[model samples]
Target: VKIRVGNGRVKGVDLGYKVIECEKIVVAAGEGSKYLFQTLDIDIPIVIRRKELYVSEPYSLFIDPLIIDTREDSLGLYVTQTLRGELMGSIDYPEAIDDLTHETTLKHYTVYAKKLVRLIPIMKYSTVMRCWSGNYVTTPDNSHIMGRDPEWPEGLYISTGFSGHGFMLAPYTGFLMARHLIYGETPNTMEPYTPDRFRMGKYVRESLVIG
Candidate 1:
């Protein structure tokens, strides 16, 4: 992806074979967002962490609600029964590694199984049939970095560093960001989440990060 930033604004983007001009650009590429902003001399502090998920074999278990067991170490353990009767869940582990790798871990599965069985004894009879991992783009304050850049006011906008809540908060984030971009107005609720909050020493803290 080619970014074109100049004259205190974004000129356009060169999509390899094509160049599309736009009045502004919003960088929300998750973990890849860091490098994209770097082209415009903007540094966003983000770390990529891999979180693994597991799915159990289909069974006739009546687990309807999403079960979540919060802990201080692993963030929390959560599981829910899908319509197909399969148990799907994930646990937030430590940030020991940094990379965009989809590698699964036997240790993660083992711990999840133990926690699942303890939380719901019926899960002891379940067996995991699949496991996968994905990248999480996290920020220092565990909150998102949104809003226009002060230096590039006429061009760049950012909406990344969501930690692990991007999927759940997409609808709300999209609405707020769109309003900010088109109307040049931001809701007071999102003022604390501006991209330059860290630089201005006004970082907001979010503690309910459940992967």
Candidate 2:
């Protein structure tokens, strides 16, 4: 787990360089990456937001495929079947908290779960076994931190702090980020997505339904 310098030879070094050299150094370490970036004097404030995911065992009923109820102006209770007919869901109105722990309270769970059961009726008696948490590192402007740094160390690159949309946009963002760093010629089509805009207050809001 440690990528630091070592006492013995490894990966072409008697010890990893106190300072290494590479064509590029990409910091895509997710929300937890802020601690490392601070070492390089890159001050990024990343918050830990808890998103709850549920796994439930079936009642004497059948629910097939993925049933997502995007109603009530929120991601409401989304129900999806597993290989064994178990269901998973989430309550989408994010309250925005620093509490990453997602020990589901019975009230929150019952309320959201029943919302789906009401819509479909088949899940009326399913028993939820667990609720868990995941983090979505969000930038203040709700975009990703991409592109090469203009000031600090040249050849250094940043690609962290995605505002919950990282997974959906990973491929295209990688292409654009690599092109900008490698050739200094980022496609103009994606120019507006650069992280620099956060400083200028020119923000772009995406109608990503899942959020």
Candidate 3:
């Protein structure tokens, strides 16, 4: 996909061979968003990281409800027994050595095993069937970046830098993004999350991010 800017305004985007023209563009490209914006000479302050997860084979139902460990050292270690009787979870750890690969490590397994076993002793016996990793889009403040880019071509909006809470906060983010883009409704609550804040050295750091 390619962005199209012309005549001092965004003309929409070029999707492969097709050009889908529009008045505005909302770039919610997650971890790749920084690169995407760079093509247009806009700098997004985002850091790319990787997170790992593990899943257990089906077993008899025992534990319920999503368990979250809110300790600072293990801020996002969470585990839950799915309805299918499988236990699934992940833990927050230092960023991977390589930021571009979804490589899983024994370190993730070893650390998560210790945390899960402490929460649910039966997890010690549960068979871990599979593990995987994915990318995370982080920011200096760990909060989101929203609204239009003041220096970019007009009609460009960004709603990324979600850290790791994008899924949980999608509905709210979508709502604010839609209203801000379509209606020019810039609420006072959103002032703290603008990308310009980073340029001005103002950060709204959040400490509750999960893995």
Candidate 4:
């Protein structure tokens, strides 16, 4: 896949089989944004890290609110019970890798098991039904990248690098993005996330990112 730019503006996207024509384009590809941005021959401060999660067999409802462990020993551990009574959560992997592989390791599972048992002793008996891995598209400051820039293709915009808060912030981000695209006005809420901030050496530091 590639983005087509002509006369210093977004013309459309090349989807291998056909070109979808459009004047305005938003790149919200999450971890895949790096590849898409390469189509435009531009670079941004984005990194991809691997995260692993597991879901346990259903138990009687007990936990209500999401539990987060931010202690020095468990910096990225979080556990929450699903509506269906299944326990699900993950501990963030400390290392960052350049590749985009979704491979989960037994070491992660063992470590998580130990930590979860320590936090909720009853959880030691809960069987892990499944495990999975995913990518955390992150920025230098751990905040999302939003809005567009005048230097690039005129109609090209960006909205990625959520680190781990994409699902939580998607609705609000989309609303502000729509208003900006339609009325050509940058909402105050989005002012801090402009792609230009990286160029200006201004980073938005967010300390609340959890696993």
Q: Which candidate is the best by lDDT?
A: 4
Using TM-score, give the best candidate's number.
4
Which wins on lDDT, candidate 3 or candidate 4? 4
RMSD of each: 2.2, 5.7, 2.5, 1.4
The per-model lDDT (C-alpha) reads 0.82, 0.64, 0.83, 0.89
- TM-score-based ranking, best first? 4, 1, 3, 2
Error of 2 at 85 (Å): 3.8
The alpha-carbon lDDT assigned to residue 159 of candidate 1 equals: 91
The pairs that clash in candidate 1 are: none
Distance from true location, Cα of 165 in model 2, Å: 2.6
For 11-102, candidate 2 gives per-residue lDDT tens digits of 11112335343445566788656765565556665665667778887553466666667666435566677777667777764565656565
Instruction: Please list the residue runs of candidate 4 whose C-alpha ends up more than 4 Å from where it truly belongs after superposition.
Output: 94-96
Q: Model 4: which residue pairs collide?
A: none
Instruction: Please provide TM-scores, in order, for all candidate models, with all chains considered together.
Output: 0.88, 0.70, 0.85, 0.94
Better of 1 and 4 by TM-score: 4
Q: How far is candidate 2 from the true structure (C-alpha RMSD, Å)?
A: 5.7
Using lDDT as the measure, name the better of candidate 2 and candidate 3. Answer: 3
